[model samples]
Target: MSGISSASGILAARSALLAAAKAALDGQTDIDFYSGWQYPVTQPNWVATTDVHADMDPANIGPRRSQDETITLGVSIGAWLPGHTEDDIVAAFERAFSILNTIQTHIRTEDITLADTVLWCVPGATDSDGAVDEDGSGYQVEIATTFVCQHRVRAA
Candidate 1:
């Protein structure tokens, strides 16, 4: 039997998923989507795609060394409003929701498989934290969603 390790499969799946998400988000034209560890909060508004976690199932289903892997990708939206008011904060939340909606739509309509790298994908729960001061300066609004992608890793 010969095949790639589960680790390799997970890494490939993660990268492909991130690239697909970034491409979809970048088409928005109003928001910037970035990958990797460098998260720039200095920007007034932006979107971030990060690989949160990866896991592999213990059981092998195929004839060779095979396991199912799940990659959790996080997409976060941030807006930094300096010297903002209540109305401003509310507006930020509205905008954030709109962006989230677009992301959801893209996932549902677009080819999430990334050319078979991912077998399947589903949007996970969403969380929001905002309307609070950022470092004692201005208000900040943040929203995040997770995508759980599954793929099969096999070597034969």
Candidate 2:
């Protein structure tokens, strides 16, 4: 049981995921990994992990001895370029998608179970959307996906 509640298990899963991401992105100086929120993003290329939602229900109808849970965690990829030209936008797009691909491949092969903290983990389809600043600050591209982690929580 490992004294793992649904909430605690979710936390453990996120931590493990962050660690795995760090390991996967290490030595790639161009990519920066953040565990949570980042304000006024400074890097041209960066990835962030955030909490999305969670679902939990009793594993059995009787006595609430255990529960099955799913926790959704988000990964956000951002690419920015100072120039606002069409070529700059294309470059940003390529960089953002390349980062997304690296992340997807790492998630697929590296830590599907989040270091045994969960039964299994899988990233959902990515949602891509972004905006360009009217003031010409930079060209920005963002891609986001969620990793759903399933686990069983036992009574403490």
Candidate 3:
């Protein structure tokens, strides 16, 4: 947590994870990965929202003074095209799968474990107007995932 979000510290974890998510989402290597991603500084909406604290107490496992704490890092991807089809949806998922794999690799490299990481995808329209088109055929695939990560205290 030293860097916490600095360009060179552990705090930049969210940035790191965001990069990994994009890379994992796109099945292509970034020619200029650094410039390709513009990781916004850790916003109060993103960082402090989660409880990140750790301690070294062997007995803190069985039970704690407070309730069990948890945090979730949610990732989402979406697209909208006039003529999207089923194949497009499949491709979107395939891309997401690739990105998720790379994400796991990056996490392991940093010695962090992903807990309860789940992927959910669906297709829908973006029109805020609730009116069914008489003759409109299009598709959109959106992927939003939540990676529940926790600072493990003990094996128990």
Top of the candidates by lDDT: 2
Candidate with better TM-score, 2 vs 3: 2
TM-scores for every predicted model: 0.76, 0.82, 0.39
TM-score of 1: 0.76
lDDT of 2 by residue, 93-151 (tens): 88888877766678679877777888777877688866676688888898887888887
Against the reference, the lDDT scores of all candidates come to 0.68, 0.76, 0.35
Residues 78-148, model 3: lDDT tens digits: 33233346575565445444444455565555335321121111111211112112354534333444444
Rank order by lDDT, top first? 2, 1, 3
Q: Listing every candidate in turn, what is its Cα RMSD in Å to the true structure after a full C-alpha superposition?
A: 3.8, 2.8, 10.9
TM-score of 3: 0.39
Q: What is candidate 2's CA lDDT for residue 59?
A: 43
Candidate 1 lDDT over residue span 57-88, tens digit each? 67656667777777787777776666577787
